[model samples]
Target: MNDTATPLLDVRDLCVRYETSGASSWRRHLTTVLRDVTFRIGAGETYGLVGESGSGKSTTGRAILRLADIGGGAITFDGQDVATMGRRTPLAYRRDVQAVYQDPGASLNPRHHVGRAVTDALRRHGLGSAAERRARAEEVFVQVGLTADHLTRYPSEMSGGQLQRVAIARALVLNPRLIVCDEAVSALDLSTQSQIINLLMDVQEQTGVSYLFITHDLGVVRHVSHRVGVLRAGELVEQGETKALFEAPLHEYTRSLIAASPASHPQGRDERRAARQARRRAGVGAA
Candidate 1:
């Protein structure tokens, strides 16, 4: 519900499909991973996509990052169509839109020190000289709560949270306008998750970078996202401002999702469950 005239990233009527084959002699299938999905993220805004596993949340993120097979629709960034970008435009687009995935250890090379992994993007894009790149890496490392000394360590030397911070620093070094955070905080413990989420908010405030946060945790979405979209069976079932959607979700699926969240107090779980059942019954009776 951003009133901004031009959003930083806009996705409309998006569809994605994967070609699969069964064990049969001649059987092939086209499975739709995402269908008619639409949403927008403005400058410095966080748009959260939440759903259960296989709900297409990660597929949507991949499509936005141009890593998936786009079956239909348009993904526009800064008023430019991503699908149609030619030659050097895609590289520029990648520079503007970076990604941070769930497994930081897998993302970072074990052989190289974290410093090289962080400044690799800068070197690829020819951003600055070695000294400048090192300075930028140190600054970003500090920004994400890491110290200068930690940069010399390899992925094996750091904790899970620290490695994730290094991943975020890598994305930040590019100074991108949009970041596709695919389950970026799901792997951490509760305390570390809170720290990372707060760090992301602080980074946004400092850099005005937008986020497309994809995760299955509704509670995390509520804490980090400005707007929330609920995906069910590859389709967007609900989308609205986070507070409003959590306070009173219009979709039955969304209501059930909220009721299922672990954040619900144990004492009130049954009451919330009953209320959700009643709502489902009322809708069915009315229909």
Candidate 2:
């Protein structure tokens, strides 16, 4: 939120391409998944990437985390070009920029106990000895609203929400500065989703971490984001302060996205939002 400070993550003109088979039997060509996408997540700020399914939101997250190839552009984090980070610095980068994936079930190793999986990353980073790391892992469990004792349990034993809590705990164990939460609560029930959202806010509050929250749910973005960027067909159509964008959308694509959202003001849509904006303007007029 500091105005004079540099951004925590800056991505410029990023592009990604995925190869798909052609109709003709023996041919393939690259399909662009993200097209000249650019954005920034500031220190201790939540930047929401809003879009529908297959809008390349996930691809952007994967590319930022180095899980996918970057066919073009540059991503810089903490003043270092992440793409140029060699073998010696990758582990360090991984420690600073962590990810909470969409499917916790698939992301977590089924064979490992939840506690072990969380601790493995901490140990790999050489944060602590066995005893210290175990204790740290337990502390993170309670931080994410999970009992320390559940560390012994395997991923297969937990529900989707619980598995996500474990995943969160794992990410927290490393004490990351920035986290890419990719549909982290999409699989949970509404009540459970609220719990996770609160947990993420609390974690950000206490740890001074920022989140790149990618979701198709505008309602969720409205609740959690400081600023929102709408992506359509691999390109960012519009972005601004969340309230400003919600109240007065300049782009038709953004308005369409707001319309498509299920939880948006259903019947009145633009009318209600416009009324609120009018009131604010009238209040300023009086002042």
Top candidate by TM-score? 1
Cα lDDT tens digits, model 1, 1-287, are 45656888889999999999879859998888899999988988899999999999999988888778689999899999986663345678888999999998997889999999878889999889999999999999999999999999999999999999999999999999999999998999988987888788779878999999999888788877889999999999999988789899999999999998988222122343466578787885310
Worst 10 residues of 2 by lDDT: 264-273
Query: Mind giving the per-residue lDDT tens digits that candidate 2 earns over 1-287?
Result: 45477999999999999989999879999999999998888988999998988999999998888888888999999888976654345787889888897788886778888899888988898888999999999999998888988999988888888999989988888889999999888888887887788688768878889999999889888878888899999999998988899989999989988887777423122343466578788784311
- Model 2 misplaced regions, further than 4 Å: 1-4, 86-89, 264-287
Q: Which stretches of candidate 1 lie over 4 Å from their true place?
A: 23-25, 86-89, 264-287
Structural similarity to truth (TM-score) of each candidate: 0.89, 0.87
TM-score of the candidate numbered 1? 0.89
- Any residue pairs clashing in model 2, and if so which? none
